[model samples]
Target: MSRMWLCAVSLAILCALSLPTFGQTFSRILFDTDMESDCDDAACLAMLHALADRGEIELLGTMISAKFPWSGPCADAINTYYGRPDLPIGVPKGKAGIQQGSKYAEQVAKQFPHDCPLYDDAPDATRLYRQLLAAQPDGSVTILTVGDLTNLRYLIESEADEISPLTGQQLVKKKVAHWVCMGSRYPADLDPGKWGNFKPDAESTVKAIEAWPTKITFTGGGKFAELISTGKRLKELPQDNPVRRVYELYFGGNVKDRHSADQIAVMVAARGTGHPWKLVTQGHNHIFPNGTHQWEVETDNPRHQYISALADGVDPQEVIDSFNELMLHQPK
Candidate 1:
């Protein structure tokens, strides 16, 4: 080979090796939410988009488990803001799920730019789940549900349809690598004890957990989420940002820091148990009929685990700073 050609090829190889390839293989994720009440869901969605921007996770689709008129649109609005305007958005079609008003869903939907149809007009969440799962490779998708289990329950119970011959449970068992849930309290949710996500759709929560075939990681951020307050940094972003609007509207014009359970859930789903989080895989989360739950020691089933703080725990401000950086990430 000519010396010039050899030099050019060598330079190319050197440059390729120098380029960063960290987290190159993206984590495939389907984010499901109930974005009608708290603002944390919106923050979580924004964090997902931000992680996608960083090439850490490939957001296959977003589904809303609630039955609010504007929740899907608000999710679409955030997706649109992050430059994925056509990302699939799904909602519960029937009146079987949580149907409530939001402090910000409507206002964010009205103010932001999105073409997603209203709740009733959107695609059914269960069907959407089946379709998304069937199309992905076996054991490749991680479902992150930071909401009521309505869609997931329907998915678990669905019969064969035009999408695939396999039932919902079969499809999920074939395709899903694991599930990361942002519901229920860890160890136990005692006393008046039913987390909002579980209580609203208690039956569904009980059923989905009982039937889900793969391992589940309950990212119970009840205590840590409160410590990891976020959303105030969103005010530093431009006024056109939908997430910024969500915080402002939810808090009555102030972008105050709110509990970050949903954000923590997203982080754990996209990235594994890193720093501050230690996985306890020795027990199973036992869900009661009323949607309340407790972690019981078990050796028979190893399909369930939950996150807890490290021995020394982590500085809350450090977590807040890191999460805010992700939440405020701009669309690339």
Candidate 2:
């Protein structure tokens, strides 16, 4: 071929390579977790990063609802381990300061190879939310809250400020597509004591739940209860892996798997329904002030939905196994 023709062919190939590999656009994700207390939250973060590596989702940033000193560091360390060292970190400061003793946060932050600044050296949750939201295209963000409603409540109640010209409610309606939260109890018949996310900050839960305008998928306690597994599979991977260390710390070398709710939230958010698991839109979830929840089949509320294990093709145990498999992959 002539030199000109060869140049044209090379240019064409380069342009094709530069184009998106698939027609599907990845979902933008903002992870909110209370990683200070439970290793399940750490597991959830690992799964989310794995999904991001698969191009199934885009992990935009992380907001720590757990105010303990280690919360931000743990989130940053995990994100950094996934090769995203610059991921934004946000922390919420309540009266509960430094009450956290994460089994692996300090360890990961100090010993592991990561670059998350200081533990508490991060932006406030609302400010970071506003900054990130303002930068995103309209109707493009999906938030996953597997922790207290403290940050979310502040974001919901915030008015127009320096971050963006839109109010919190308006911003959510305009910018956020939906949110998948790990809280509440479904079926309305379960004992209130079964729920946990509501109480630590009941007022925030009520305000945020009542005010959010976009669609919400609540991954409550009942449906995802079966996502348990012995971290043995994950532990054998690598000692440098934060997730491996987390499992070791939480389980103390036990061979039995432990139930984790946050993993379900992340799983549903990334690969959403129909792969055996599906959502039940029959009714909406009701949030009480005392942090207890009941799912009432009310035609009045259509903007909310909850996860269920009753789908035709779904085997709860199989779903749990698949999620566990995702968790076992070493962080890239």
lDDT tens string, model 2, 175-292?
9998998875566633555547766777888889999999898885644564344345675566677877777767665434666678778777776644555577787777777777
**Candidate 1 runs further than 4 Å off:** 1-25, 193-195, 298-300, 310-313
Runs of candidate 2 with Cα error greater than 4 angstroms are 1-25, 94-101, 117-120, 189-192, 227-230
Highest TM-score: give the candidate number.
1
lDDT minimum window of 10 residues, candidate 1: 17-26
Pairs that clash in candidate 2: 229-257, 230-257
TM-score of each: 0.91, 0.85
Error of 1 at 56 (Å): 0.8
How accurate locally is residue 128 in candidate 1, as Cα lDDT from 0 to 100?
Answer: 87
True-structure Cα RMSD, model 1: 3.2
Instruction: Report lDDT (Cα) of residue 18, candidate 1.
Output: 49
